[model samples]
Target: MSYDRVRAVDEDVADALTGERERQNDTLAMIASENHVSEAVLEAQGSELTNKYAEGYPGERYYGGCEYADDVEELAIERAKELWGAEHVNVQPHSGSSANMGVYFSVLEPGDKILSLDLTHGGHLSHGHSVNFAGKLYDVTHYEVDPETGRLDYEALARQAEEVEPDMIVSGFSAYPRTVDWEAIQEAADAVGAYHMADIAHITGLVAAGEHPSPVGVADFVTGSTHKTIRAGRGGIIMCDEEHADAVDTAVFPGAQGGPLMHNVAGKAVGFGEALDPEFKEYAAQVVTNAEVLGETLEEHGFSLVSGGTDTHLVLADLRESHPDVTGGEAEEALEEVGIVLNGNTVPGETRSAFNPSGIRAGTPALTTRGFEEAEMREVGDLIARVIDNLGDEEVYAEVAADVQELCDDHPLYE
Candidate 1:
């Protein structure tokens, strides 16, 4: 983790690198999609495999000197298969979005219809936001969570599926706090004769540890980011039945991306190995427990959680109900000022702009990775409430900043 080598060659880059390391050590990273990979995973990601260009799958490469690349990729693929229990797994797509793209390419032609959750209601851009390529290439419709319950209505979704009759139905979410019923979604897709693609990008680790219901067997295709809840390095994965294995692999390679980042695949392999250990189940369980504690604490302070609470590692709070004057963007800035970093998120039935939305999303994957438990998470929730309650109070910021520093010291990272 030292920047000595970089400093010898490039002082500017080295300074930034060192500063980023220091910042991570100092702040509480509460971003829903972020987590700290172990040093082993980090080292694997920073390995010399970065120079490799093994453009194809194992035992079927397009170039020479791919012996090591093949080994790394095979190990990653095998580990991912074991982790998610898929008949076939592709550890290639450069990102989760790309993984979605690969799946889309494998089956649907351009202009084929897609049905997914609304982005403001917890969907990802790749699900078909107007600005994304998926939106441009596909005719996309949406299903919304029940406004009253703030949860999916399976019957309503089924009705919508029949009405839209989309070529595909995407399950999984970005900011949702509840566990998904993949079978329900699958049944909807079946009635409509549509493919069910469950994007478990945010809940990969939870699913792997059996803390959440997995979509591997229920959905036609499953995609996820390796880094989010899993603590794998930055990468995406695709899983499908053996029947679609060829199509998925080809789509991932020549269809969506070329020359996989083998270093990242190595990181995935290392992290997956770590996840297979018995302790990872405990870590995954703690992540959910901490999130519940955090959500409960926030609720105690008068904040209204989007779905009322969490069954996963993240919770989304709608500021409109409690602090009507404070926008999510404003709360995000004030929280960051005190070294607590999360994101301004858009809630269901959003009444504000996406940039400065009505909600804030907080998560516990990074905190749990840093050894934080329920008590520490509760304290964090209190600090967040204090900051949000007194946004412009400089004295309060100083007090919270001191407390954050103390918490950081108590649970040191990369030490």
Candidate 2:
């Protein structure tokens, strides 16, 4: 609950909302997949449009009085198409996972094969972890980066594609720090006649701003979250060539999700508008720059980083090397004590369980949105390293909390 932002809610509602906002304002948010959306996005998301339920696609509808909802949703769809240079766009998957699932539905049958990156090595669950629907319904073939260098082995990936002849080859990751070679993946997929999907949720903003390579033209299907880098509402979108438009749209509408959230669609419009601005390009560039500096700072402070360093906004730290006794979860909790928030993650070949893995994933998107720059990120990196180093020491975290407060004070959000 963010008290400072919501005035219309009752006392209790305001109290809850304001509390969350206050925490967000105070904390250093380094979670790789998180970001603070603009105020306009928030306003659109919580607008009166939520009161209506307009099931079906933009122009075609199942219910009466969907005129305005149709306009809003259509605007969102057009904006998405313009933003990503996609021939077709479906902005109603509810989440990136859902969007991935819809893409699967569009391209493959239930028992078809899929080749995706290994989950523990950086791929998302939707790519085909055992517990996910992708793994449950499909014959999933896993690929891994070179264990020695912690980087993608395109040659090995091509070899696997040739052997498996998978129905689809997913090229993306949730925790990877290096830039993906979309063209390489396209070649790999083409060699085996496999469909290609790029889950660019984390890098959508970077791609839009030309800070990262765009998968829009290269991938057969591109899926992403509106919130992470795009700084939009909390939802997912699917982009593809004109060839797959009908199948993808059907998969999202009657095939998977019910009616779209008109309110969130409105929010998506606001975010897309913001992303189209020139300043968003500058912001996206700074996001990657801040992350690289922070990653270096963490390495200099004795933390072992995944893939040596980050070329993107995320940095995955292997805490096992620097603090063998402290698990990722422990380090996460310790950092929270000092108002620094980040998620524990699994590193490649991690011996520990996923719930308490050996790595912590951090990023600069949220802090950059909060107006922190490269210098602040370096200081944040140092503070994060200190917190992880002294996990069980209460006095140490307390002292670090003071330092965190000072930093936050210097770069206060929403003042």
Number of residue pairs clashing in candidate 2, backbone atoms closer than 3 angstroms, sequence gap of 3 or more or interchain = 10
> What's the lDDT for candidate 2?
0.89
Candidate closest to the true structure, highest TM-score:
1
Clashing pairs in 1: none
TM-scores for candidates 1 onward, in order = 0.99, 0.96
Q: Candidate 1: lDDT of 375?
A: 90
Candidate 1 regions with alpha-carbon error over 4 angstroms: none
How far is each candidate from the true structure, as Cα RMSD in Å? 0.5, 1.8
Per-residue accuracy of model 1 over 43-111 as CA lDDT, tens digit each = 999999999899989999999999999998889888888988999999999889999999999999999
Q: What is the C-alpha lDDT of each candidate?
A: 0.95, 0.89
Compared to the true structure, candidate 2 yields what TM-score? 0.96
